[model samples]
Target chain A: MDEFSFIDSIKQKYYKQPTLLKGVGDDAAVFRQQNKDIVTSVDTMVENVHFAKYTMSPFHAGYRALAANISDLAAMGAVPAFYLVSIVIPADLSNEDAGSIFSGMESLASLYRMDLIGGDTVSGKELSISITVIGYTEPGRARYRSSARQGDLVFVTGSLGDSQAGFHILANKGEYEEESYFIERHRMPSPRVDFAAKLSGIKRVSLNDISDGLANEVNEIADASQVTIILNEKDLPVSPQYPQFPVDLQHKWKLYGGEDFELVGTVAEDDWESVKEAASNTDTVVTPIGYVAERSLSSKVYLITDNGKIPLYSEGYTHLK
Target chain B: MDEFSFIDSIKQKYYKQPTLLKGVGDDAAVFRQQNKDIVTSVDTMVENVHFAKYTMSPFHAGYRALAANISDLAAMGAVPAFYLVSIVIPADLSNEDAGSIFSGMESLASLYRMDLIGGDTVSGKELSISITVIGYTEPGRARYRSSARQGDLVFVTGSLGDSQAGFHILANKGEYEEESYFIERHRMPSPRVDFAAKLSGIKRVSLNDISDGLANEVNEIADASQVTIILNEKDLPVSPQYPQFPVDLQHKWKLYGGEDFELVGTVAEDDWESVKEAASNTDTVVTPIGYVAERSLSSKVYLITDNGKIPLYSEGYTHLK
Candidate 1:
């Protein structure tokens, strides 16, 4: 197809707005922001690394790519503004597959009012999609990974290990043919943008999403804030069938399995009750998992089990591994 | 490497900045724009299609990926602000190779004062790099492809066809070993950012980067503007060794070959002289190639030859093709 024709079709499908002064077919898209600071994040998903190549659907791949990046913004407590997408597909893939991916992404983007501004499309040896999401927040309202104080209580939105369970079901054969919850959780994740936005002035300390598992993310916050994180293993919000997996193995997996795109954050102990009430009103779950303490990087993450306190292992998905 | 550690190293190397209110290890990087509108563009380079699978050096791949996207901002006449990069590499490639790519991109980015913000990395079947660059421009200073008018004079900065020639020689056996002019052009063609910035207030008719060659870009301007584009074949610029190709295809290739990241723009003929002079003073060559005119739906591009005007053919790289 001619470049102009391709771009024109995309613009018609995606760039509909009074805010978009320019969109596809231009060298760059221009946007007017009411706020001064702009938040941006870029996330790339590959065929085998981020997802299993053969088992994944194109639509799910598209949704997951945007969802993962949008979750990052939620971690920052920033509102989604615009996004740029880059897709590299194998030459063997059908045009229908490519279109479905865009359709899925466009569906989410339109729902969020995230403008699909500009990006590159090319042929590659594997299917890969990278999205750069640009967002905004009140200049000082944005949260970071360095603000948690010694007495802050740590919290996480929604249940953990659902994504891991979802992945297990989706990656395996017959056991979950009718498991829509598992498939949907694996495919589409809510970024918790509204919840994060509500927590704006309530003092969110050391915020981030659970992409690299809950324990790994806690370790990240601990390392960044130079503080120790003490967790109550019994308090972990697990699903009803959590005991089906081996006891020790499941706990380890729950804390280390990546792709749990929930927001893990912290707040002052005093504000915890009010924050929980506000979150409940918004229909967003906020569970207190742990507390932040003085910096002790040597063994920062600890899990309180019935046996005794144990160091949380850092066995999360490593890129090289 | 663990995701956090990889991201931490990337942040230390590229995202060290005071203006960056927040950066990588966080959910998103927040930047203070000082009340400037953000101009954004994204470009991706895939292994086999964009660059030869094993021919282009990793450093060159990195350089080209960043340079190509940077050229888009230059086409829009916007100044560099910040960038986020997403890379997908094969599992077999060592971290050193990835480091080399980032180092090379960093070299170019430093010259432009582009803060490397945040990104995601994953292992793919082949190498791919996607960069999203955001620039700061005056509210309405951006030039677009739909604003060209009848009687508007077409202008291009720097010479064309050199990159095409460079690709031709580099693809042939034993030709890439020497330091040829075409090879240099292919490896590194400077984006005309300074010249583009100067043309911000001159009432630009239309603007676009000449990637996929000048013919494709001029057609884009014409189609977007709903006008005919007439080009003088003799007036086309040529490199010093013009007749070395197999046939007298210098002008033909310049009109149709891809990978020339020069800016092709249109402005009122009245201001063309002054614009040309100003561009020349900066050692930036600004040459007139054609004029805009009314066109029928079917035939919009006409090549002005000694024999008379004839229908122009589409010859650049088509993504769908």
Candidate 2:
């Protein structure tokens, strides 16, 4: 099928949003959202830089690309509403592979009731997918990384380091009974939109998604909020099978390895109970790993361990200089 | 400069939207657009497919990418507001080149008061840019391709094939007195957002942007509106230097050459004067080219010439099978 036919098939099969004034097959998509603030984010994943053809299936690539963007929306305390995808297909890729990519995105989108409003498909030297997601939050209530305050409890949702472990296993072709769990975590991370929505009741919260590793994310919150953060290393949450990996690898992955798609944020000490209640309501695990304090000179992040306090530098996967 | 520093520089320089609650340096950007319909469009340009290093400058590539997306919003009769850019940077690209790309977009963005809200930067095999633009229109006032009426007058804004001729000149490295005009046109085709905003006064207008050539765009409108459209060949608009090229090349480019970034639409005969006045107010040139008719069987588009009536096929640059 040609480009038009493929788009038509997608529209017929998946473009069903009654609230959208127009969706697909137009110069632009139109919709109306009254009385809510709009949150928008875009993420792009390249072939080898993000995922390899041998290591990742097309469906997972698609799912991961959308998941990364959706995680951003969740970090901002917003509800996923609509998304537009732009894919660059290499010559070697099959039509079925392309379709699988969309199917992968659709699988995640359906769970959030997000509409596939618009997108562009083109030929390129290698496969690349860029997704722009639009979400909604209450007026003046969207969370930011610059809102952390002294005495606030720094928390993280779900287990950390699982995705990195999963990726390591896939890259090395490791054989283990727990491989599927790691692979699934890496491939299909659940965006914490539900848990984030529950935290909206908090008067003020600071959030940053753990996409570029805990070190990088926490540093960002500290820098943005102009506060120092101290995390208890022993309090870091890990999956059940995390202990199977070497101790050094576990430490590295949990602290510096990224792509966990978990939420790392700070809430007031008084609101900690509300946060815990919200997490319990959503069946999400919440762990208080750190606390925010006044910055003496500049913002800094540190980890407290049995040895001593060590500086937590931003050592995540930075793309370019 | 590292990734964070580069983003920090961008945030300091270009992200200055007073209305945005949040901008760069966050997981997502937040803004509230009360009591308005949202319009969004995305466009992607690959290294070799859409442009080349030898033929286009970094600034022009960046400018053109955003221009294409803005044109889409214009066709929907919306006012351009905010945009997110996702760029895949090859290793060979210099920091200056990347900065130039954003500078190019900022130049156009400043003209329309558009905010550089959010985006992603990634390392890839080849240079690619994907831009998503968000605009706003009065509730229920956005135009659609499916709204053309049988008695509507088909019209086009400005010249059609200048961009194609300009691209030909650039690719061939030809030297001529009019070379700069064509080159400039090819590099920075103006999107008709102002004209589109003016056209909003007219009710029930059907519109499409000429990014896929006149024939393909008109065919799309015909197909979407389920009406027959007949274009008068003698009435097709061309630039002053258009006649310098061979007649066949002019004919082919005018019909099949895309990327003019002009608006093509149909307005009711009663609203024709209103359209003309709107164009005049915006200092835009408007020309009547054809008329919409009842579809006998399937919707079709045809060109009326001295030779006879010829069917217009959707022969634009379609990617993939």
Candidate 3:
């Protein structure tokens, strides 16, 4: 198809927001904001590393790309406003597939009242997508990893290993895609933008979405805050059936298999009650599994097992094991 | 190299600005802005279609990618403040080469006083770079293509066809890369941000950067404003030596060849004197080559040549005998 028709197919299903002065067909998109600092995040998902046709459909890949950036906005306690979808696809990609990709993204954009502002589409050696999400948060209200303090309680929303567990199911073909509980979790991580929006009312919180596994994300907070985090293995919110796998493999996926979009964060011990109340109002299940303390000389993160306490490796948290 | 060290290498060479609340090593880059509307543009440059290693180095590719987005900001009359660099590369790219790419982008970012805020680095089949530029324009004062009026004078900055002329030299044999003017023209079309900055002080202007071609850009302005544009063939600022090529090919490059980052815009006929004064004060050359008129039954864009008056075709504009 021609470029104009291709662009029309994508723009035909857009959700135009009132805040947008202009969307596509302009030199640059224009938007107005007040009383909020803009929160921006960009991420790229490539064909084999992030997704494959065998693992997920083109529509899911498109949704996942936008979801990844939205996950970051959730971590920042920002409300979705607009996004730019920049995609590079193989020359031979069918027009139908291209339209599907945009349709999938439009479905999610519609959900959050976000406008698809401006970006470029170009042909590349393989399918690769980069989405830049533009959001805004109240001044002095957005969460940050560096704000966690001593005596804070570390809480994580939802399950930790659903995405990775779903990934394993898709990678291996024992179960059908639709029948398995893991496929949707792996393919469509409904980013917690609403849950994050609720947290802006509460104060003294620091959070991050678990995209690079719970262990890596927890360590990032610990390192940024210069505090020590002790996570109780028994308290980790895992899928009910995941622990049935070989303990080592189960622990591997739960701690380090990445791609989960759950928000893990810390709240001051005194404000925990209010944070929980806000989460309850949003119907978001936030589970506290650890506590922050002063950092010692050795490690910033520790994982307690049935045997004893062991230091967690900062890099991937797996090298020690 | 590991992702950590690769990110660290790039982050180490950055020039931080006070407006940036946070940079690399966060969930998302944070910033503060007031009074101005946020201006955003995202563009992707693929490996072979946009650049080949034979014609441009990886460093040049990285620079050109950011330059493409910066050109959009220029057209919007926005002062570029931050940009997200999302890059996908083959797994085999060496650390030194990767560092070179970031250095090239950093050079441009430093010159513009723009912060390299947030993005992702992923593995892909071939090199692809997507840059999202975040800028701010004076509230209600940005130049738009829809604002051109009948009887307005259309102007272009510097010269056209240099980039395409430069492209032919790099694509074919004979001339080496260094000694010629066209190579740099092709490799680095310095975006007209300064010129646009000057125009921001002027009122009621419409502008766009020539990415696809001058004819395509002028047609966009005419179509958007619902007016007619007429070009004087003698007034077009072609490179002095470029017109020496065969007349047909010369016209082809001048009128149709893409990738020229020059600014094309229309201003009220009365503002011409003040606009030229602003351009000269900034050491920028503003050349008036056409005028906007009420649309008639003929083409929205026309070129007056030796043969006769002819409508400019929106697609490539190459239909003269």
Candidate 4:
């Protein structure tokens, strides 16, 4: 199908939201959000750079791209409402694969009842998907990276390093018994929207989605909040199958390998119980792996390991160096 | 500089808006829009496909990309407010060139007092920009392509095909005395946002931006509105230097050449005067190009020329065929 027909098909397939006045077949999509602050994030994933066509299916790529953007909204303590996807299609891509990409995104968006408002489709040399998601939060209630306080507990949702391990298995075509579990983690990451939405009731929490691994993300919180973060290495959450990997690779993946799509944040000592209650309500696992400390000279993140207290540098997936 | 440093530089350079609760350095940008309906459009310009580095400067490409998206909002009769830019940078691109792309977008954005809210920057094999612009209009007041009525007069803002002619001059390295004017039109096409913002006062209108040439835009309006559009070829506005070009080339450019970034729509004959007044108020040029007729069998667009009336086909740019 041509671009217009494909768009028409998408318009026909996706259900509309009550607030969406206009969806497809318009110069712009129009939506109303009453008395709520809008949270928006844009993310682009390119072929080869983000995913290989052989290793990552179009469906997974689409799911992961949209999931990553939604994770951003979740980090801001917002509920995703709408999204626009701009996709650059390579000539070699099949129509089924192209449709699968949208199917993947729709599968995730459906869980949140998010509408696909509008986007652009173009033919290019490589397949790339740039998604812009719009979500809503109460006025002045959205969480921020700069809100972390000294003595606050730094916590994480779900297991860290599972996605990276999954990716490693997929890339190497590993035939381990746990290969399916790892691969699924890599292919279908669950954005912590439910857990984050519950955090809106807790005041003054700092949050950041772990797109760039734990070391990089906590360091960002520390840098933004002008505080020092101390993480207990043993407390880092890992899956049951994580021990199957080499010890060194496990350490590396847990620390540096990115694309976890889990929330890492800090909450007050008094509010820790509330956070745990929120996690329980959402049926999500929450782990306190670290604690915020007063900055000595400058903001820094440190890992408390058996070796020693070593500064955690942002060695994860630095783009455009 | 690395991606983080580059983003830091951008965050430092761009000014913030009062409505913007949060800008860069977060997972998502948060902004408040009180009671206004949000109008959003996303457009992606791929290098070597939409533009060539040799023919289009980075600054112009950036400016044009944002301008195109803003034009969509304008077509919906919304006031341009904020934008997010996602840029894919090739390894070969210089930092200065990379910065120029944003500079281009900022130049036009400053005119509308639009804020550079948030976006993504990634390294890729080709330089591409995907921009999502968010604008606001009064609730249920945004214009649509399907709003045209029978006996309405079709109107367009500014001259048509100038950008195409300018692009031709630039691509062919033609150094005519008017080359600079045409080149400027091609590189920095004005998005008629001022005139469109004034259009909100009009009661009912069908609007479409002439990005994919007038023929395609009018046909879109016709198809959406279920009306037949009859255009008078003689009434189609042209630049002062337009006649100097070959007649056939001018006709081809005016009809099929895209990237004009002008507004085209149909308004009631009674409302035509109000549109003209709105144009005059904004100091914009407006022309009566055609009239909307009742759809007999199916929606159609026709042109009245010296020879006879001819059916207009959507021969504009069609991506991902």
Residue B236 error, candidate 3, Å: 0.3
TM-scores for every candidate against the unseen true structure:
0.93, 0.97, 0.95, 0.97
Interface RMSD values, listed in order for every candidate: 1.3, 0.6, 0.8, 0.8
Docking class of 2: high
- Model 2: fraction of native contacts: 0.94
Chain B TM-score for candidate 3: 0.94
Per-model CA lDDT versus the true structure = 0.77, 0.89, 0.81, 0.88
- Candidate 2 chain A: worst 10 consecutive residues by lDDT? A10-19
- Predicted structure 1, TM vs. truth: 0.93
Winner on lDDT (3 vs 4): 4
Model 1: clashing residue pairs?
none
lDDT tens per residue, model 3, A1-321 = 766667766773455566677788889998878778878989988887778788778898888878888999999998888989888868778888977887778778788888888877777778888899988888978789988888899999988787877877776667443336777888888898888888777777899998888888988898788889988888898877776556777787778867779999998888888778877888888898989878644338988879888887654532111
In CAPRI terms, where does candidate 3 land? high
DockQ of each: 0.75, 0.91, 0.84, 0.85
Per-residue lDDT of A224 in model 2: 87
In model 4, where do residues sit more than 4 Å from their true spots?
A12-14, A173-177, A295-297, A318-321, B12-16, B173-177, B295-297, B318-321
Best by lDDT: 2
lDDT of 2 by residue, B1-321 (tens): 656566656653555555578777799999888778999989999988888888789999999999999999999999998999999988899889989988889888888989888888888888999999999998888999998889889999999899889888876765565988988888998999999998877778999999989999999899888999999999999988888887898998899888998999998899999999999999999999999988644999999999999988888564212
Clashing pairs for model 3 are: none
Where is model 4 chain A poorest over a 10-residue stretch in terms of lDDT?
A312-321
User: How far in Å is the alpha carbon of A119 misplaced in model 1?
Assistant: 2.5
Candidate 4 lDDT over A120-168, as tens digits, reads 9888888889999999998788999999988999999999899989877
lDDT per residue for candidate 2 within A86-193, as digits (tens), equals 999998999999999998898999999899999998888889999999999888779999999999999999999999888888878656659999999999999999
- Sorted by DockQ (best first), the order is 2, 4, 3, 1
